[model samples]
Every structure is written in C-alpha cells, then in structure tokens.
Target: LLDGVRGWLMAGAEPLQRLAAMPTQLWRDVSESTRSRSDLENEIALLDQENLLLKGQMQTFWSLQEENRRLRAALNAAQPLEQDLLLAEAIPVKGDARRQFVLVNRGSRDGVFVGQAALVAEGLLGQVLHVGPRTAEILLLSDDTHAVPVRIARTGQRAIAQGTGNGERMEILYLPSNADVKEGDVLVTSGLGGIFPPGYPVATVSAIAEAAGGDFARVSARPLAPVDDVREVLLLWMRDTVSADLPKTDHAP
Candidate 1:
C-alpha cells in the first residue's frame, strides 16, 4: 500500500508542474510573434520609402527627356534661318509679377545689342532691352509698355499690338471698326518699325469687339511665342535690310 501511494503522488505532482509552466511558455510564444510582426512592419515601411524615391527619380528623368526633345527641335528650326542666330538660355527675373522680361545668358560680349530681335522655335520672343557683360535683359511682348508693329497676314493691314500687362493676351490698337480683322487672323511683323525683322509671326487674333459708335475696335491677340514658358531663345543679328532713316514712330516701346 505504501509503494502504490507514493507512485500516485508522483504522477499527480507531475501534472501540477506542467500546469504551472504553461503561463511562461505562452508568454514566450507571444513575444516571438510580436517581434516578428514588428520586424515585418519596419521592412514594409522601408520598401514604401524606396518606392516613393524611385517615382520621384522617374519623373525627373521624364522631364529631362522632354526638355531634350524641345532643344533638338529648336536647333533644327534655327538651321535654315537667314539671320545670324545665337543660342542662349533665358531665366525669368524675380521681381514684380507684372514685369514680363527675362535675362538671357548672352550679352554685349556675345555681340548682343539693344533692340535686337529674339525668337524661339514657335515665333518672335521679344527685343533686347539692356545688355551687360555676360547677360542681357529682353523686354517681352507682354510687357505693359511694349508694342510691336504687326500686319494682318490675310489682308496686309497694318496695326499696332500693345501688351496688356498680361502674358496670355495683347491688344491690337487703332483698328477701325470696319477693319478687315477677324478672329484667328495671324499677325506678323510688318517691317515698318525696322526693329523686328519682317514676316516673323507675332500673335493670332483671339477676340474682336466693335465699340458702340466708336471708331476703333477692341481686338485681342495671343502671342505665338511661348512667352510664359520659353527657356531657350535665339538672339537674331538681323541684317540692315531697312533704312535707318525710316520713321521711328512705329518702333517698339
């Protein structure tokens, strides 16, 4: 009877010992699982950061490719031009927003001069205003004080296009109500002022409003040049085709 009682006591104690160890084993398993989950979360965050960086790099690469294409197209356009062309990069000056002028990399040292015509692949850009040693300021077509002598390509009717202090629009002044002007009429430099070369595109008529009983019509035009976004420009050394004794009334302001 004593031996049997001792064996039964041993068996019962073994079960109690296993029951006491259950809490520790459960805590260890939970801790391992939590650590694994935290590590996975950290790895996923790192991957997301890398993905965003790669996307930003891809956008920059695409922008560079587009810029390269535009540069090539500009070069091709300049190849057959009659005037002497000097390639220059332009940067917008930081100042009043209404001032529509840009600083070009070329200047007096590069033979740039005041009143020189500037152009891009699209059309006429502006006229050179001030020239420094290494840079020049170009008065854009959209400056409030700027004006260009333009003629309607369809009828050869002469008129003046004045800047409205707006980059997207210009005003054609002195057009009679019965003038042969219409929407979508192309305006080109008429060689009357002799500042800008003749036959260069200036703007396209966008709107026409006849003033009630007034002599002049209110006409609006959009510049053909990418005035708001042009980065590269060609400074033209136009030949002396027009006489210098020509009237300066139509000259650019």
Candidate 2:
C-alpha cells in the first residue's frame, strides 16, 4: 500500500509541473510575436513618409518645365533679331519690393546700353537706366516717374500710361470723359515714342472712374509683365532704322 501511494503522488506531481511550464512557454511565444508586429509597423511608416517627399519633388519639377516651355514660345513669337537678342538673368534690387526696379546680368560690355528696351516672356519690363561692365539697372513700369505711350488696340485711340508706384497697376491720365477706352481693352506701344517697340503688349485696362464734374476720366490698368516675379529678360538692340526715328528724349517721362 505504501508503494502504491508513493507512485500515485509522483505521477500527480509530474502533471502539475508540466502545467506550470506550459504557461511560461505560452507567454514567451506571445511576446515574440508582438515584437515582430511592432517592427513591421515601423517599417511601413517610414516607407510612407518617403513616398510623400518624392511626390512633392515631382510636382516642383513639372512646374519648372511648364514655365520654360512658355518662355520659349514667347521668345519665338517676338521674333527679336538674332544679333540684337541678349538673354539676361535677372538680379533682384534691394528695397524695391514695389517692383519699381530690377537689375540684369548684361551691360555695356555685352552690347547693352542705356535706354535699351528690356522684355520678358509676357511683355516689356522697362528701359535700361544704368549700365555697368557686367550689370545693368532697369526702371520698371510701376515707377511713378515712368510713362509709356500706349494706344487702344481696338480704336487706335492714343493715351499715356503712367506708373502709379504700385506693382499691380498703372494709370492713364488726361483721357476725355467720353473717350472710347473701356475696361478689358488691350494697350500696346503706339510707336509714337521710340523707347518701346511698336505693337508690343504693355497693359490691359482694369477700371475706369469718371467724376460727375471732372473733365478727365480716371483710368487704371494692370501691367502685362511680371515685374515682381520675372527671372529672365530679353535685351533687344533696336534696329538702325528704329533708332534713328527716335526723338532726342529717351522716354516720355
């Protein structure tokens, strides 16, 4: 009887020990699985972040490509003389945030001179005011002292477009109250003043306000050139015929 009882106790103890060890083994397996899952999640997050950055870079590249294409088309349409065309890089002017002035990489050594016309992809920027051996300053159309002789594309009515010292717009002075000009009318260089080439785009009329008792209409226009954001310009050397036709004055202003 004693032997049988000892055998029974031994058997029961073996089963109890196995049960305790089973729980430990289960805990170890669960911990290992959790760690593997955590590592996978971290890797996925890193890949997503990299993808977003790549998308942004692609967008920037396409935008620059489109801008260059437009610039090329405008250059071809202008049909500037090969000998007269001087491609110039823009140099920002300090303290002229109003887009009143800009500098270029061309100068007297590059065949650029004072009073030469500076054009961008869209339209005229200004005349070269000062020249250096390797740099030149441009007087933007938004300068208060600057003026361009412009005519209405529809009616051939001539008017003086003057800068308002603001980057976004200019003004036309001394228009008769009953003038044929209207909003959305296109303005171009009239060839009356030799500073700008004739038939070049300048500005578009934006608003017209006439006082009840005033004799002249108050006219405002938006400049065609992007003076605040232009990066390149064309320095056109006027043909001999055009240069001789110019009057003694450099510009109207």
lDDT of 1 at 50: 100
The per-prediction CA RMSD against the true structure, in angstroms, equals: 10.3, 9.8
* Cα lDDT for residue 77, candidate 1: 40
- TM-score for every candidate vs. truth? 0.63, 0.64
Sequence-dependent TM-score of model 1: 0.63
Pairs that clash in candidate 2: none
Candidate 2 least-lDDT 10 residues: 244-253
Candidate 1 local distance difference test against the native: 0.80
Candidate that scores best on lDDT: 1
The Cα error of candidate 2 at residue 13, in Å, is: 70
Error of 2 at 184 (Å): 0.8
